[model samples]
Target: MEQVPLRKIIHIDMDAFYASVEQLDNPELKGKPVAVGGNEVRGVISAASYEARKFGVRSAMSGAQAARLCADLIFVKPNFDRYKEVSKQIRKIFHEYTDLVEPLSLDEAYLDVTENKKGNPSATLIAKEIRQKIFETTGLTASAGISVNKFVAKIASDFNKPNGQKTVNPDEVEAFIEVLDVKKFYGIGKVTAEKMYQLGIYTGTDLKSKSIEYLEEHFGNSGKAYYNLSRGISFSQVKPNREMKSIGAERTFFKNLSSEIYMEERLNNIAEEIERRIKKYKIAGKTVTLKIKYSDFTLQTRSKTLPYFISDKGLIFETAKELLYQEKLKDSVRLLGISLNNLNTHQKKFVVYQLKFEF
Candidate 1:
């Protein structure tokens, strides 16, 4: 008998997640540049719809700049609560296949389908199925990349966007990397790639020719990671760590709120989402945190740890609401969030938490 290895990984990234969500919920927003983010004079854009991109709008840019770039840019603040619901649905889909799923953020995740729950051995098929499920459930598209390793899989997923996919077979690994831009290599960000360019390392083959010492001299530990990734060698393993040392959810509103009625409504939703996730895992925590993004995009978080753990929605909202009121910022509220942390040790024992937050 011959021996075979079992290491299959896939990366999933939602295309313009927030903006897509707005389009999904509002028929009129499709095909139009939509920016979902802060509107305050000082706030920055959080998500830009595909339509908005044509005008050079982007997330995390000054709202004013995004507006100036496209006079027609329609700004719809993020509906985090709804997005979380969609996220939960997608996560359920992932769990149906593998428990070893790691969600890096609200919009991205990695799945270790090595020994998937569905008994589906083909990682490519699993990625396809997951992307399909996400589209069907959320009315938004996702891009997926499948490969034997995470780095290749991540790059593969990004190869196509706004609903795209790519896969890299193990045998074609080195060649797949050789043609990639140096910046596409794992751990190679814009700045680092510029430095690599200065070293005349423009492609995987160029980086491969350099001695380990040369790369180390230039990039430190990250250089080592880049070198390994170029060869399709990733030692990273997928583990479930969901209980979370901290649990939090945030949403940017479509319009800034100066009234308590609207703010409370949104805050309650944020609290409820946290509570729902906490209960989904059958865990509780003593600390409650409230996060706020003012009209200017200036963010702040305040938290308090109670004497005992709780999963009560009302209590969590109240604690967070009070915290928000205390801040009493002189600006409109653009975003609100709630979080739980410092769980009782007993909570950790019963729940097999899967960790998905990754870089």
Candidate 2:
């Protein structure tokens, strides 16, 4: 039987994307602790610079806590338009090497360069060239991970960060994953890591020792994924035209509100944002989900699927309004979000083509 060749995957992630962009545009902000988005009074940090990170500031952390951590933290309002422009420039650089570019967000992407336009034999060299091109083109630094598969590549990318890269050879894959902490696994979050720890699964080796049945019993569908990932096995492809499952916008209020009227006003704004996003992507959705987070950090989601897809702001707002009143307030609400799912952007039918290494 002829053997299938290994793939060459590279995961490229911009270093402190939002915060770095802020510093690049304003030279004075360089070498200083910077944060993009939010104020000390309200909102959360969208991104923090490496300097701010030294003080334990992190994305999704409340601005107040960030300020308490670093009194010198400089807060800058987010300019997504500018960030998107830079992201486009970086993506253009990736296309020079390969078209199998799957962007995870504005700041990171996975590229399948096994059969690239450049005919480059070394995935490591391709990753280096791509990162260099990104720095030269946008004055931004990117870190990369090169491996035979996307799962290991994504994790390896973070091993050396803020302008660095790591390459996991095919022979080194299994051992590299063995010693890694469960928390460092790409899909494993803090909550899942804690659960794994409680089960005495602190490292990849420990996780690998568990039976598939045991993991599935505890983690359900995700357990199967964990089992595979522990053994350095992942079959996920780098899809250039990855589907957007949902589009949503949310806001966290500075103060918790008890009034439904105030919440309605906020929902209108969020609905408008959602409409804009769907329009930008030229898609509509049949399902409108209203996400509410109480002051105590409890979350509630109420969804309504319409018979037909809709993307108008007025229509979206009306649906969200219905959901808002669908249930009474449990506690003073701290956040409100509006999302549209069951989108009109249905998956396109295509034949799968596997690109393999020559060797």
Candidate 3:
């Protein structure tokens, strides 16, 4: 097997992205506790400013709860269009350094700068330059992490946030990971962290001590992933605009429905939503899937692969309706969802237009 070269990977995350954007456009909100969401009883916060974070107000928390955390918390509705435009501007900056940029979301992206246009040998210097350029161009701060692989770099990016950067040299990878809490591992979620805690695995060092067989027995396929990640090894590459494998939306209803007529009505709305998303993303799939959650908490899915790709709203609704009624109901249905899959293969197009960096 050929040995892959040690690559320079940098993960760039904008500081409190959506909230920061809100603050940038509204100068009055600067240095004040602000949250972006619906300020209603059941409304959830989408983003919280650094000032709001100090009071333990956070994204995904209920708006009512957030208000309680910070009595004077300012609520601002999110403007996704404005956020998308800012994200585009930030990506243009990454292109100036490397073409291998993979955006994680509107707030963060991974850049492979192993071989860059500037001929700079130091990834640390490149990260510093990127941060400076982002601040100058967007009036927004970005925190960056530089390392030999994406996993470590992504974790490092959050180390010193709100306009800071950290770099883990190749020689320092092991020691850097050794002391990290398992909960801090990017892929370990809350549930997994609790499971690890039960197993007496609190940190990377503890995880590293587990034998592969033991990990596999405990975590199944994820065992190998945890094994490699704990040792600072990542074979994953910075894939650009990875293909859309599936597109779907689901909802859990407040009241479960037993009538087929009501179920079909909900399915129609879900199908329309899926079609809208497919059009927005400029992608379509051949397979149509219908998902159902029963009042008893049991779930089931039915799917059919079409002979042709489709993006039409009418056809999506019709197909979903047919799938919904294909089988008799076992109990009252609580949720209905539709998704498109087996995506159409698209010719990858790279945007050639480039704007020169002023700095």
Candidate 4:
């Protein structure tokens, strides 16, 4: 049997990233309840500081609701360009250790440091150093979690916040997961957690007690994942420079449009954008997908796979039109998007050579 190497993974999450950045830039915002977004009735909060969180302010909550919760909540507009620059700096620091870094977002990432540049055997030490370096360089605090796999590492990262580190060793993996709440497991959202509670599976141990057949009968495909997670058996790797799964663009309108003509115009613009991105990336895809969002916030997607790969804007727009026309609109659409998938552009390019032999 082939031996599988025991990998060391680290998941790093910034401590209230946008909020922290806001506080870092302005001294006055420090030690105050801050939210990053417009403070309008319809505007939503992108992030909230720990102080604001105390008053139930949260990301994705309406500004009006946040205001009602916290009367003096401070709102700051997001600076995405500045955030991107900071993200680049953080990525640079990660690459100094290992290239096996998977960025989840601007604020979080997973790093596989099993064979790091520093020649360190201990993942714990590497995570510690990385956190320290990030703080020293970016004036931001990052929480680190080191474990044998990405799943546990991500959960452990949240164990300590605002600058902390935690390690779950190989020997302790089983015990560490057994007592954990089922809700804490990755992919187990609130709805699923409620279902789990109904089934009396509140912790890892309780989940492990249920037979695979029982889980499958209830959860379908997710049963396998839940079974594996209960045993600390996630096999997901820290993939670096993961190819773009799909290239797409979307737009949300201020008002819903019932006319197909206006939607087709929007589709043309979206297709043009997708084509430009495909050309820029030198990618050709066979699958085209059209996404529509109704005024009621319901989303629908229709897709078709062509016989051959294409990156042409005309074809993209036509295919999207075909998909859109195939199904009658259930309601007025507020958003339209176009995307391409099934790409093979990242394949290696090579020149074939013929060998001549003399006897």
Question: Considering every candidate listed, which one attains the maximal TM-score?
Answer: 2
Q: Write the per-residue lDDT of candidate 3 for residues 1-359, one digit (tens) a residue.
A: 32333578999999999999999999999999999974744456889999999999999776778988899999997898999999999999999999999988899999988889998888899999999999999999999999988899999999999799999988898899999999999999999999999999999999999988999999999998898889898776787776677999876565668898987777778877887888889988899898888876677999999999999878888888888789898998766888889998664653222222211
lDDT of 2 by residue, 30-112 (tens): 99999898789868799999999999999988888899999999999999999999999999999999999999999999999
lDDT winner: 2
Full-model lDDT for every candidate: 0.80, 0.91, 0.87, 0.87
- Residue-level lDDT of model 1, residues 1-359, one tens digit each, is 21222368889899999888888889998888888875634356888988788788888888778877888888786688988888888888889998888898888888988777888767888888989998888788999988876678888888888798988877778899988888987667889889989989899888888777877888887777776766766766655674358788887666688887788889898888888888877878899888877876687889888998888999889888787777567778877888888875442332222323211
List where candidate 1 sits over 4 angstroms from the true fold. 1-6, 242-359
How do all models score by TM-score?
Answer: 0.68, 0.94, 0.82, 0.82
Clashing pairs in 4: none
Tens-digit lDDT track of model 4 for 162-269: 699889988788899999999999889999999999989999999999888889999998998898889887767777766678898876665678999899999999
Which regions of candidate 3 deviate over 4 angstroms? 1-5, 249-270, 280-282, 286-310, 318-338, 345-359
Q: Assess candidate 3 and give its TM-score to the true structure.
A: 0.82
Which regions of candidate 2 deviate over 4 angstroms?
Answer: 1-5, 348-359
Model 2 local distance difference test score: 0.91
- Model 1 poorest ten-residue lDDT run: 350-359
